[model samples]
Target: MDRRNFLRTMGTAAAVAAVSSTELGAVTLGKDKKKKAPAAETGLRVRFLGTGAADWKGPDDRGEYRRLSSVLLDNRILIDFTPTDADMLPEGCKPECIFYTHSHADHYNPEALLNLGVPTAYLGKTWISKAWKGFADASAKTGVPVPEIVPLAIGETVVCGDIAITALPANHAIDATEQALIYLIEKGPTRILYATDTGGIMGVAARIAGIDPHVKKGTPITGLIMEATMGMGDKGDEDYRLFTHSSVNTVHRTVKMLLRRERLLLKDGESVYLTHLARTLHPTQAELDANLPAPLKAAYDGLEVVF
Candidate 1:
């Protein structure tokens, strides 16, 4: 389908459940059950189901095991999926669709997609053909029907119910022919940049994020969920993952740059959460949270935030 017609069909097909006006604040799920600063009743809700990188083996220091990376938005849309996700999915969560960042095994799982039975799945246009074949093979092996696949190029935006998602080029790569991606999510006045599995923001993504004043600027981002795959301090500078992943130092520098450019908005508490943490590299979640600068916190599995 053409872009205009494609968008219209998706917007109607994936509209979320009606939002309630009740003032339910954000709360992280776990033994501690810490609550965040109160948010507006109509704020965008993001729940982290998994926060680990490709090396998903480890209990950290606190005996907490993070599955592969994935998130549920407003409890209706999912960002990435993995087989392990079934272990931690919130009760009553019926995700309408999924938006994948890339075709990495750690980020995308065809089995989970088939099992979950979401109606549609969207991803970067560069590798959609390969994805279609993969989905078809999976459908043939199993009895379930394949979810409809939608190809989205960088700089393209689609409306799904009350949310608007824009695809942006990521600095990471799986092969010479593929285009990895990050996402820009908009709901009402709340704008969030969900960047992972990529190096620091650069190229078209920088222009879209308003990092360069010379380029046409978009709306300021009200919140951010970025990856810090490398460990604390300056370890990422000399590590091999520096090219395709973010480090603690990289996140700090990027946040400072965004603040200076007035491109990012900070909330009262923890406006930014670092995900895709490497289990072998990082310390316990509490220690990580303690070391991060104010408003920039480490995200643990099952954490919830309303922006």
Candidate 2:
């Protein structure tokens, strides 16, 4: 609802960015296996079900299928929806909630939304307007009423089950060519940032003020899911990209802005998962993987991760 109320609802924060606190952090590596525990005690199980998005090949491409970025947390809560081949769906997989990071065709595919009966949230104005305009067409094919369109205001938080999700205005053109959204998702003691469709990090640091500046990081966020659409090296030259998207170098600089400034954190072995890739960009999965300091991995469709 309102900003004040929303922050209160999150209960606690992870300015320190630690695990064993957020939904994503519930994931235990091979050795952490408790003397063994029950499913409930383990917490929500998140899995990467797909790693694909529209134009994975290019603008003209539809879906030849190598990857489509989509994640199913405990078989519900889809991070981004893309048109994916039915064969790629994980066995017995079904999502209950869909959170759109932006309004790009790659992130919100009309075909994919057609089959889902669950409600979805649009965290940005660009995405809200685009989806609302197409509501009629999507409803007709699905035989389901248009989804309950929840309009999220910038800096507002919503409770999804046990998770508290907040939207931060992401940098993307609101013009006809594109519409977009980015998110900061939190649960219990963990905080997770889902940022996509960014071109630079300077403005992002200024807009992400909702994150309480005092909270220690590792205590809250167990993980970060960011974009690396561009590659390494100096990005000071391009005027177009600077205005609309972030390159790998920009992403790195942004990360430093947060972690170094204590806005986010990195545990001794904790990690950062990169998703929503643009293959045409300079940062290839190999490049991001090989160059990142540590605990970083390329996110693909169907890839599930813990905070």
Candidate 3:
């Protein structure tokens, strides 16, 4: 799509009205909300609808399995959508928006997105044109009108309801021209870092999470849902997959550094969950829990948590 057509489609008054309906009128959440507030008063609900690497394919003999990686926040915003996620959504659930991490098949499925009937889908500005073409072709085949595609650059923030979502550059690479992303989500006093399809925390994300000491610190992270695609079994720093996916040691070291810098906010003994696990490398959840260190738990397909 060209610039004029893209702008005309995305900036129309009807599109704006559809997007505006997502804004919560009565919900008021501020950064200064009392730390001691009740859970129902200051918490964001997150459901892990799918949590697996690219290699996962349905169920296995051990009765262990996972679908493609995806997350639903407050049951309104989706981090990613996949074809397999249709069966995972709650009954009568209707999401309003979707924020993509990249264009990888595991993270972005045009059919699943169009099927959701969401009003808006946010993507990185560098690849929105390509994304528009893909969505247009899918819509032609499926008879579903394409949702508005909102292009966002790194560091850009968009407000949906009382939530503020900021995009951060990811350390992963797909091709020469595409840029992957992680997100920093905030609601009231709760802040969450959703990092997936990325190797490690990039410099910009590290600075924003207050984990980089040389730069000005930003806010502390309340919860983290990160990917560990390159499992911990026998992978080392020299592994080629480490460049695009995180391993066990990588997550552990990063979390330790963040803790030392006081960049993570945990309440009532909450732990960070690891998603996008590889079926071949990582063991069952029982074995994983026995092996992983404190505050790093394995995420399952139906796991839900509040932060």
Candidate 4:
């Protein structure tokens, strides 16, 4: 009904609000993980948990929750926590580490955290200039002593125990008020950059694929998870959605720029995964695959990959 009440209610359960609201909330992702999903079956696993471009729902209404926009990494690291993220965290996938590139309706999963305790002791995404203030506000309210916001710059690293994360700037929205963050995660030979809820990176995205002076230096792209949100055109044209969000061709351009021309360092065999699809373009997975560049696939809910 109200902001405070809305936040409080979301803290209760994934479907608590849906039951009361006319427009259903997110679908529910079971809390129980099926299997450990061995490397062979999982293959650098990355579960989409909800792949809708903007609106979210339970996949198939099977009671499985789709998120606004979020990615659970290695079953612990969280790229973003939309309300649906709570529904996406199928059992055995509760995240221990959380990283927010920016604070937005979909990016900030306050309710998701309430469903699973807020990760006050992890890499938090907050303002670069007002880091301490953000931490204090969180602490003041949640009473879950906030962790260091780790004010991260485009190339700076946010180390969590053994994991190293880098935050990059991106234009978050078309309306042009909110700023967003793109993240680069590294642990040994595997490196991942998570970009969502924003237009495709234009300039530095190519450089990001190149050698980084701070990181392992020349690590090539082993795994990449991008967004193919506007795969379909607007108003059901199947070709118009291209202008608003990145699509198959857009991804091809990105890969060509990052991998083909730059010759950026990458492992011999790397898999690039794309998420955030247009509901209108419910293309067969095969059809979606045929359009992407080499080693790229559209992301789906509950897709899991190991770095």
Candidate 5:
């Protein structure tokens, strides 16, 4: 089948196979939740809808699982709409906006949004044009309304409600011609640096994180949701993958750089959670927790962090 036909088939499957609420783990807030806040008053909450790299494999017993790389913020802002994300929209949650990190199929699924009806979507200029065309084509074929595609310029901050978001440069792509983005999201006093699908946090991202206009100096970020797709693998083991995804060593080095530059100032209990894990490079979640240092943990699907 051609690529277009394959995507159409996938979209049909995704629309029919929407996951049940049971598949989504129990919703729990962070340690700070003394009494559950009213639904209308719920503050910043982030949930990892998927936490695996593109090539991640399920265990033998499961046969096949569809956990891809995506994060849902406050159940209303979605970053990346992988197939897994499309299959599992949180119960009673309708995201107002969707943010695309790049044009990678894993990060941006045009079919997933066919029926979602999300009002606004933020993506790079190139991606915006591509998405508009793709959705228009799909809509003509399937009769679904094409969503509004807005351009997200790198280094420019866009505000959605109370949240202020800036798209920073990401060093990742299928090749030199492709473009990628890493987001820095700020809500109220809490700031989160969501950097994934990138080899390392350098260039414009490093500079922006080091001195963000929205965040005050010496104030630590509420959370740093980063990717560790290569685990602890050496460059010699896999040369091609290392150029786009980060390893455990890269995570550590980036963290150190942020600290050395006073870019990340964590409070007594704040932490960094790693996502987009590769099964081949890491062991079970239990083993990972037992071995990883304090404040750095491997995140799993349904994991929630409230700030």
Candidate 6:
């Protein structure tokens, strides 16, 4: 089917499901009843800056909007710098470090990072030269000093304040020379797996599953922030598969693999959130909540979670 036809069909199904069901918010693993606590009081907090895929058009008058994907960690660390405008950032927020998944324009905006003035930024080892070029171009255009750029290797861990971050290899940008990274962040007892902008977890799942042995045995993952760019589309779609982004099928498969491998052990109250939404492929925020199972709802901008 053509893109337009596919989207129209999906939208219809989503609307139908939404009208018939009612369940919203983040998806949690297992089943239990516990009061949801504020992220500020919790050890780790994550706020999604933008939840749209690269193809996402800007917001419209009807309030259907999806910005490029990015997340703020405890308002101190930023995962990606896309759509990095003053309004997108939290008030009084200053990140100590910004982590880049790749050099994709939607994930990394040099001009935006220049304005933020973060002290340090991390990128894949293969991205240093490309990043330098971007920084140089931005500096010439904006007259902002270049921030320090650190190269990250797969499986290498870097300590940023209280958070221990490890960059894992991802299966993305196969045609490009630059590599992609998925982050594993840990603070106190809270551990979060931040995976986005990747097609599948096949190459990286084992490494992720092995992370538990490196930390305390019983320290389950406090949260999972994953990408669902393709939404509930068929995996056989050529355009979707070619882009190396996740669909509902791949996301579920990855989650199940993690659970079976004991890589991601969720405690009673932990939750899973799907971000990087593609408007054409997925339903609206409310419709998505109504359609998806518990602990697997779509994430929206300004949605904050603490674990």
Model 3, position 278, has a per-residue lDDT of 84
Instruction: Between candidates 1 and 6, name the one with more favorable TM-score.
Output: 1
Best-matching candidate per lDDT: 3
**What TM-score fits each model?**
0.87, 0.71, 0.87, 0.65, 0.78, 0.79
Q: Candidate 1 has what TM-score?
A: 0.87
For every model shown, the clashing-pair count is 0, 42, 0, 29, 1, 4
Which pairs clash in model 3?
Answer: none
* Candidates in descending lDDT order: 3, 1, 6, 5, 2, 4
lDDT values for all models: 0.78, 0.55, 0.79, 0.53, 0.69, 0.70
Candidate 5 off by > 4 Å: 1-43, 57-66, 211-220, 233-239
lDDT of 5 by residue, 1-307 (tens): 7533543444343333333322322222111112322233344788888888776655434342437788888676799876566656677776666888888877777767666766557787656667788778867876878775667667756555455677888878765555788888777666788988888875767566554333455445656888888876475136568778888778777676666666676667766888888766676787778887666788888878886
lDDT of 1 at 274: 93
List the candidate 2 regions with Cα displacement exceeding 4 Å: 1-46, 49-54, 58-66, 85-88, 123-129, 176-179, 201-220, 235-240, 282-288
Q: What tens digits encode model 3's per-residue C-alpha lDDT throughout 195-287?
A: 998898998877765556666555788888888887775563556787798987788888887777778767767988899998877888889
| Over 4 Å off, model 4 | 1-47, 59-66, 90-94, 121-148, 174-177, 208-219, 232-244, 262-270, 281-286, 289-293
Better of 3 and 4 by lDDT: 3
Q: Is candidate 2 or candidate 6 better by lDDT?
A: 6
Better of 2 and 4 by lDDT: 2
* CA displacement after TM-score superposition, residue 200 of candidate 2 (Å): 3.4
Worst 10 residues of 4 by lDDT: 29-38
Q: Spell out the clash pairs found in candidate 1.
A: none
- The list of candidate 6 runs beyond 4 A from truth reads 1-42, 60-62, 208-220, 233-239
Candidate 2 per-residue lDDT over residues 59-81, each given as its tens digit: 32333233556666545467776
